[model samples]
Target: MSSTPANPPTALHEVWLIRHGETQWSLSGQHTGSTDIALTDHGRAQARALAPRLATQSFDAVWSSPMARAIETCELAGLGGQRVIVQDLHEWDYGIYEGRTTPEIRASVPGWSVWDSPVPKGESLLQIQARAEAVVARLLAASGRVAIFSHAHFLRALAGCWMGGAAALGAHLYLDTASISLLGFDHESRAIRRWNS
Candidate 1:
């Protein structure tokens, strides 16, 4: 009989990424960043719904964005006591573009994209990418499963970083409010186990 190793090289751990419940701005398709906002009634219900889904899972660590929406979601999901607020998990700072809709921004600057266009006095793509990478690093180091509650764009950037891609690639990942995504190793390779659930 062969002896089994204490720690298998193929051991897989999961990082659960959850976008905060819907806010008024989210429903209105507005750019929400830095400006703290509250969740709508439906959003609260959505957050409460997550409790059952997460009840059975055990997480080594739980983290949340400092923003009210995210913290509220984390609390409603029954992980508030376990959550450690991470400032870097906050959504991308949109600066002058904050609370504006994409169409509104386009009206002023044609063909402007949050991913492609620069936000005046706001965080750069590199800055967001760096923060995502830091979060990924911490998640990867966790001994067991970990959970994070954050914003849509921030979670998208985090997923991109977990897959070893540039933060700008997050534009391709469309995440809905109060959705769940899973990131884990697939036979030693980074993969998205689940998305926008």
Candidate 2:
């Protein structure tokens, strides 16, 4: 009798990253870090619309930042019941730059960018990268599909880290509010299957 292959190839794992719906600060182009903000009506609708798409897939785990906007989006997306709060998933601390837009900040310091410039008392790019790496490690250690609800900057950083790139690489990936992205393997190499959808 022929025997089955002993070492079967395992299925590719996926990490689905979801950015929280829009908030007033997000709309105003403000740096909203460590701020407890609620979503707008349109943002709520955006979150609700994600449910159908999410329902199409079976996630082995669901995670969300402790921030209200992220948590609310998880709830509206119909995955709140299964979500585990991850404080490290919170947005990068903007420090004194909090509530100020890049342009506004640039008014004083020409061409200031969170990705390129340092925010006084805020999280450094390296610091945020470390957090992203930690999350990526956790997800990689787990089996099957996973989902995460978080903010824009943090999600971008996570995507960069997933691809084995520095968090500064996030500056090249533009993510919209309430968007969906996928991180998976490409023939044994980590890859971004989809982005900012």
TM-scores, all models, native as reference: 0.93, 0.94
Q: Which ten residues in a row have the lowest lDDT in candidate 1?
A: 1-10
Residue-pair clashes per prediction, in order, are 0, 0
CA deviation > 4 Å runs, candidate 2:
1-12
**Per-residue lDDT over 129-190 for candidate 2, one digit per residue giving the tens place of the 0 to 100 score:** 99998987777667778899998898999888878657888988988999999988766567
> What global local distance difference test value does model 1 have?
0.86
Position 34, candidate 1: lDDT: 85
